[model samples]
Target: MLTRISSVDHLEVKQVVFSSVLQLGDSCILNGFSRALAVQRETEIFYGDEGNFPSYRIFKKPLPLPPITESISFLRHNINPIIKVNNIDVTAVSNSSILHVGNSQTVSMEVRVKHIRQLLLEGHEQDI
Candidate 1:
């Protein structure tokens, strides 16, 4: 297989976070995994209590999904092998994401996120 890229004028990538990949060209296999936990509280609370949170415990455990068993095939017939690209502008790629250009054989990605928001008022604040 022959791949010809003419030009890439401008490419702006802001952020690539949490087990992400930005690949250009041919690839045989790509695998990515990410896990995140975000907690927001109205008032400052005890940092040590984070371990008691249920969501925290879940993140500690391994992913509880079955294994992947699949097969894939690709056949490419190019009449004009000249690939032209003027410009590419990207904002963000996050959380086990992949931004790939050209040929790829296999790609796998997984992401898990847990968000908790707490807005509780104490006894004095509740009266007001």
Candidate 2:
């Protein structure tokens, strides 16, 4: 398998709020050009809790501005992500552009994989 540190990136938010949280989904899109990186045609996406920077704060009102501490981190590890273009395993990020913090050591994914059986969907119940 090809090893690459550049498969993913990060984004910082004032707090772990709704709109920001939704940005983590599979088809989530961010509308901005990469400042100085190889330009890819499709919308770019960042992933994992390694990229979460939550600024926490308690307000007298329902919502607060300029949070104090980081909270509610979301991270995911994927060996064989279904994304058609690239498969990635996001580790972590902070105040940097595409920071790489994992090992470059090569390992076989085939030897360790366990098959997951899919359950069939039927209109009527069948006798076992």
Candidate 3:
């Protein structure tokens, strides 16, 4: 499993009210990238709710089965998320970028995570 953190700034808005609360949707499918993390296993995504940050719900679903392949399948991809504040769609200026806190404005954050196995043990030649 892998995790990362990134930030963004320099945002412009005319009129937008932020969400005061976050409620998880009953059934919501994660986006392509977030869903990809659930390959063959269920996963939960948590975002924002950091120090003085409002929590946001991404999605709720079971793990998706990855494509069957005889050879080893390598996973390599970066997730670029589009952030939304209080039902306001914030255009992603760049990949994995968030809007900059403007004057007298606030921002909320969110994250997603999925893990299959907790522990795995492999034996090698001359090495247990």
Candidate 4:
């Protein structure tokens, strides 16, 4: 979205709001050569880039939901924070770091399979 700010000089400025989101973990490294999409800007909250990277990292540790039950207990229990590490010197960093939560989708699918397996394993001699 292009937000035009009109100042006294009628200057037009731009602010972007990304509709899509990407997630990354701490000490994750990726080169722009692999990602064809032109990564405009990268931001982080924690003290990312702890490895002295040469590539820009998008997000620090993103929280993934549990395998079966979607609960916020882990997040609440942990003191790790969502830091804002924006306006980075992209050319200077090769890797990014962050506090990561568990993978949500994978966990959910695993839980579902386990549940169905349990149901099927139960003895069934009903005549209905």
Counting clashing residue pairs in each candidate, in order, gives 0, 5, 6, 14
What is the per-residue lDDT of model 2 for residues 29-119, given as tens digits with 9 covering 90 to 100? 2321111122232222333322122311211124224655866787767676432324334333222122223332322111111222333
Residue-level lDDT of model 1, residues 1-73, one tens digit each, is 3554434456678888767888776677888887776888777775676645454766667666777688878
TM per prediction: 0.66, 0.13, 0.20, 0.13
TM-score of 3: 0.20
- Winner on TM-score (3 vs 4): 3
Best by lDDT: 1
Tens-digit lDDT track of model 3 for 37-114:
322312233333322212223345434656767888686675643223343344333222233322212233333444
Candidate 4: global Cα-lDDT? 0.26
Residue 66 in model 2: lDDT: 60
Task: Give the alpha carbon lDDT tens digit for every residue of 1-128 in model 4.
Answer: 11222213221223212221123323223212111122222232234444333342432223375476655553233244343343322222111211222222221111100111112223443421
Cα shift from native, residue 50, model 3 (Å) = 28
Candidate 2 pairs with clashing backbones: 48-75, 49-74, 49-75, 54-70, 56-69
